[model samples]
Target chain A: MKPLDKIQSIAAYLDEDAVDTDIIFPARFLLLMDKKGLGGHAFHERRRVKKGETPFILDRPPFDTAEILVAGKDFGTGSSREQAVWALADLGLRCIIAETFGEIFYANCFKNGVLPIRLDADTLARVRQAAGREEEIVVDLPSQTIVLTGDETISYDVDAYRKEALLLGLDEIAVILRDSGKDIKAFEEGQSRRAPWLRLGPDKWKVFDDLEKEQFIE
Target chain B: MHAHDRPRTLYQKVWDDHVVSTYQDGTQLIYVDRHLVQEVSSPQAFVGLDAAGRDLHRPEAHMAVADHAVPTTERTATLREGLAASQVARLSTNAARHHIPYVPMTDRRHGIVHVIGPELGFTLPGAVLVCGDSHTCTHGAFGAVAFGIGASECECVFATQVLRQSRQKSMRIRLEGVCPEGVQVKDVILAVIARIGVGGGVGHAMEFAGSAVRAMTMEQRMTLCNMAVEAGSRIGLVAPDETTFAYLKGRPLAPTDTEWDAAVANWRELASDSDAVFDQEFEIDVSSLSPFITWGTTPEESAPISGRVPDPAAIDDPRVRRRVERSLRYMALEPNTPLSGIAIDRVFIGSCTNGRIEDLRSAAAVVAGRKVHPRVQAMVVPGSASVRLQAEAEGLDRIFSEAGFDWRHSGCSMCVGMNDDRLLEGERCASTSNRNFEGRQGRGGRTHLMSPAMAAAAAVSGHLADVRDLWPEGTK
Candidate 1:
């Protein structure tokens, strides 16, 4: 995983709030069984383009170079449908800059390696203006600076843990595993001592023991 | 202690009792007593189990229902909506495979999961329940700590039988004086949401109490709690009272005979102690509230029937101003438009929120001698088969039919667009359902959330009309 030093691109701009999961990826396409081709229908309901649209959001000029989505308040408000996050991630949107986001949607973005950035109204207006002018908007994660093509810039901050997670591509489970490294071995030893029912037989035991032995050797 | 300090509301008591363990990170592991599952989110849980070769940890504590994706029409063969049919069938299959009790669409117990939980006595007082559906807060009317959980969290509960959660502070909303005629529990909740704004109750549990709430029926209490989520609260509760005990007396899973007497005795003690403390308190004068209607996209963006649509400029807060403007555009309403004269194309009076027998009865009473507007499409769907049967037995269904409304089978019909029942694009509807978000009913469909009686009045008048005017003599 690469640490995000600066976001130099202003990929695309969505104008509305509460863009629900149902519209993001309709339930009809849930039958796809795989995540492939989902990007084609990212904003199917609202997309003005016809079917067989080329390059999807990437086909649009200024949006093609934009790595961030500047959106309205309460962006992604309804439903806990994770497919919304998947579709956006598949579209290669690295970050979303909005005034506010739904609690579940914000959490899902972090889980899927999308940095959700919150900015004040004046900053949002500047980005919106830049988007209208087809100008490039740059966001520097480390410096917390968002610069427009007109030489104007604004600073914003994100939570430290969320910043680390996005930079390392670490999800909640990954964070938990990282924090529980020592606890895992202690838990395994305690389970073997007190509740051996949790332990596996010889064939499975070999796999576990081999891993434990490798850890000891390391 | 202040008046708000009495027993700290039911929300506080239930939330405090469910704390399992506090984590070093400030989150707490709250024990879930009953977990309701559905097909939409449970497939991932089963896949997770299959990957780990792990059996269900507490199958007995969990129950499944097919409601969200179930087709409401009477088609026996293939359904017009293939995805919905398959989702319903998958729920049945998964519940059977896991040995969890399931109420399929063909079963007598079939209905919205939230409605069935309380009807079957699964949502007992002081229990902590969770469902994949957001309206799970409906169970809190039974004095239980209930809220919605995400799919991954659902899997965690299935494996460990406990959910990790942080404790929330409590808010007590006290209603003084008797409820004025024509005003219902819906008006009380809507008024509270409008006053507090949508995020006022964030990170807190709300307990509804006082003279007004105490006088309400169990079904009405359920309606009040059902919209707690719209206020951004995790749970809403009313203390178990005589009305609550009476409603649960002959329920299928409720205690019987001597056990019933003992249970009532115990339930009576579930009220808050006189000296209990709550973090915040709000009071509303019930007499002042009238029949309410949501004119905008959000539930909190609502006003009384006689009031005019709010001007966005009048709202000083930028977020609220933006919401007001956006809602007006989606609803196609002018800033100063009177709510009374706004015409509607359809009327829907059903959902887990307000589709119970009491709700049906209230609507039926309004439409009994009236005729539905010829241009309007009106529907009344019962919450459950039991409610349907009860309405039919009392000829309430006939009253609806006589007024030219379609009285259909029980399901989450028209509340969400998943099923065949949906509002046409660009058509405005007066609905008794909880959400009024844009396109919630269907693509380009407009929804105005209201009470069942108000929906009934709108069906007859073909516009947003006050139900109080229909019953000048008041709820007799």
Candidate 2:
């Protein structure tokens, strides 16, 4: 993950609400475990060029190279597939602004270094209008502001911890392992003592293992 | 020491019990009691773990299953050369290498992660369960603090067994009165989503309570919580009661002998205090709910069976209107058209949402002595292999087979178009799955979300028909 301090790029608009993860990254490609080169599959159906069909916004000139996406309400909704974030990030999109986002998708964005911004409907419309005009947008992480054409700037709120995570490109697992190792172990020991029923040994596994060994074929 | 005296919701109790420490930035490191993994979303997490030189923190706390892309028919042979095979193989290899318990594809216990976890008694009351799949919240019917996490978080749990998290506000949804005849528990949840909209539960943990909720069986409660993600809530809860306890009493993984008594005593306390306060509250009378189904793309774009397709022009909000128009275009539906008369090409009767044995029983009851409409290709995929065996033992599979509905193996079949069971272009389906998002079933496919009984009725009638019409004595 690259540290994201500032981004300036042309914005693309998608005028549809509740654009789900399946739409962003279809389930057919979910079997590809590797996360690289998923951008080609992002909005796979929409990007397809058929005879006598209008070209998709992302496939049009200027917007074809866009680094920011302005979407409608509840964007990135449905499915817990993080590949939705990966697909956008792999597509060279650095930022996504929407009225709202699915909570899991929002969290997945920070993990993959793609910034998700939640703006009010009015502010979102302004962003969309700016994108429709093909204005180059600048998003400054440190200032938490989006700079549009004519130097018009709009401020946004982000979780302080997430903002820091994005700015520093911190590996959360590494941080937790370093700072909370003892704390986690202590909690586990205490929890086991309190509720011994949760600690299952090989005996519990015997049934599943026996079944697996006996019946490995369909 | 007086923490016990303050009235806290069920979410608070479960959260408080699991907190390991608090970071300076106010993110709490909560210990996870269970981590469930499936094939599709877990492969990359395992790769990350390998790259980080990390081993499992507590292997016993994790379990894996393959359901997302596994073929319902000819499982192994169908997966022999494709991407699905490789993915399932990776999960199997990852689980074995990490010493994690994995229920293999052909194992009798094998099934959708959410379904098997509860039935096998792995999902415990007051436990913190995280899975890579959103439907992990289905376990919340056991009064657990369960939510879905992304792959990065999956790797984090794999290494440390803790998550850095901020607290979500609490919302209590109280369903009062009994559901009218022909209105299944699935209808109750659909009505809630239709009332609350898709984003209604955002940034909150929803606790489902009241008379209707209390009256539901454990399977029904699971169905209710399973679709909470579609309502945009990561966590969903139901206070553990006798229904939950009774469901888990003799399960293989549940506590037994003297330990069972102690576990029950502990679970009995897993409820909201009498005067507990919630950040938001919603009350709905279930008596008025009808058999509900989504006529548009989003789950919120649904109405009672008697209603008509919503007209975008009639809606006041421009954003909502545009969304409705786009959904109507994708669904090929006309505004003001009756929802009941919409013809469908297929009927899918399995998913983490409604693939349990009781769901099968209800659908089988409706399909008994009736043949599937020739125009509709209908199939029933059990939630788990055990669910399949139980259904077979009860002769439900025979009823479905005799009725010309494909009685298939257990897996998340047509709910997601990952496997062979998919909708062809322009094909519309009546599915018992959760979402109705554009192209969710197939690239150009349309979906209508409903209950198993409703889907069965749609199968026989070749259109969206009210299940009440089939039940002459009215549904019990």
Candidate 3:
């Protein structure tokens, strides 16, 4: 995964609180085995203005060129459907800025290599206003600076570990692997000593052994 | 410390004590005590178990139930849907394989797991409980630290009985004074959500306390805790009181006589000390809270029942404004439209959240003399077989039937999209369940979350009218 340096273009802001996974990728779309076609149907209910015609959001100028989303608090609040994050990612939304995000959705965003930036209410308002004006909004990850075309800029805070993960394109699992260099072996040894029943299956034991080897080698 | 400076909130005390080891990555591996499992999401965890060929490390500490996918009609030999049938069957098999106690569909003890847990005394005060179902926070009413977990996390709990959690800052939400007449606990939670704007509780553990909270029954507290997730909090809790002890006194899993006495003594100490600290505190005057109805897709986008739908253009926040407009368009609701006159097609009055005996009694009281609207479809499902039997003995079922509601068996019918019980496309329902998420009741079905009495009132009126209007004069 390429490191995110800065965001250049702003998406026409779509604002909704608790935009659930169901609305993003409806249950009908879940039938499709391939995830590539999902981006086409992203926000399908909102895309059709008159059942057949493309909706205003899709036909609008900034949304057509936008690669980032500015959203409200509790953005993406419902079910733990990874497909929602996948749909956003496939739709070319590289970054999302919100005042707050759902616990699971925030994790999913990082896992899918999408930058979910938490901004203060004032900063988020500015970004939302900028999107409305079709003005360029720039977000420099390293400097934690959000700049609008009118020479307006704001600095936001990101957790150091999350920033590192986003920069390295590593997820929680990746971080676990990276950090568990010796811990995995120690955990396995403890498991073997404490609970012998966990060591019954050769395949099961091999799975843990493989995980240890993978993390140790890395 | 000043009088208000002391820890007057229950959230502060629980959070402060539950902090386990914080990882270098900023996440904490908080210890979890009780793990609750259900048919819907536990199957995936079992599949993970099969792949790993792992046995449950603490099977005795885990419990499973069939709730979401089971039918409310009857515990038949076979289920109507193949997937639903297979899921319930797998839960039974998996529970047996792992030595986890299970409340299967056919069992007389069966019901929504969250409902039965507290009633049967499985949810103890101060214990951390987690389930794959979102409303698992319902257990928090018993003063238990509870929240929802995903399937992968459920596996982690099954394997280790401990969740890798990031501890939240505590927020004490103090509600002073007595609740005004006709204002139910549901309204209190809604008012809190409305004031907090959903994300207000994010990264914060909310402890609901004060005179108003202490006055509520165990069932009412459960309803308040049930929607904690709606406020974007992982858990909602209240300190255990006399009401909590009374509710747990004689249940099957509750402590025996001597143990019960001892348990009560310990539970008394669970309250926050007068000098405990909290990260944040907010006070709400209970007298000001009114009956609330959600008008938009989200719970936070709500207003008083007598109030008009908010115009998105009037909102100062651009993000909130844009979403409100979109939600209004999708819901087919107009700005400034009167919420009272909107018609409802169905009424659902059962879930882990609000399917207890008291909730049924309240609904039954409202439906006693009123006939359900001619066009509306109404169903009354109890939380568990025990609740159903108790209601039947009290003739609550007859009142529900007379009012044109289908008095059905126990299960999480219509609350989630796992079962055959669902609202048809474009159908609007007055539901007593937690969550009004799009497609939660059914694909394209709209849900209006409310109290059971409010749902009953709507069933009779066939609209989103206020329950206060339906009550007899001087009754409140």
Ten-residue stretch with the least lDDT total in model 3 chain B:
B1-10
**Mind giving the per-residue lDDT tens digits that candidate 3 earns over B1-476?**
12444544555444434444456776655445567788766776787666766667567667688787777886665573366666676777787778777666666667888888886677888667788756777888888788776665677667655555566777788888877666777888888888887667777777888888888889888888888778887788889998998888777666666656766776787787777777878899989877888887877777888899889879997766888887787677888999998999999999877899988988887888899999999998899988999999999999999888998889888887566688888999998877787777877788888878789889999898888877755433
lDDT of 2 by residue, B367-438 (tens): 898999999999999999999999999999999999999889889988888988889989999999998877
Candidate 2 TM-score on chain B: 0.98
Candidates sorted by TM-score, best first:
2, 1, 3
Judged by DockQ relative to the true structure, which candidate is superior, 1 or 2? 2
Ranking by lDDT: 2, 3, 1
Error of 2 at B100 (Å): 1.0
Better of 2 and 3 by DockQ: 2
Among the numbered candidates, top lDDT falls to 2
RMSD of each: 9.0, 1.7, 7.7
lDDT of 1 by residue, B60-136 (tens): 66778767656665524434346665666666666667767766566667788888888877678777788866677
lDDT (10s digit) by residue, model 1, range A26-111: 54454332334567666765665577775445557757656788887666654555556667777777788887765556655765
> What TM-score does chain A of model 3 get?
0.80
Off by over 4 Å in 1: A1-43, A49-59, A64-68, A93-100, A106-218, B1-9, B78-81, B255-277, B310-322, B472-476
Give me the displacement of residue A214 in model 1, in angstroms: 51
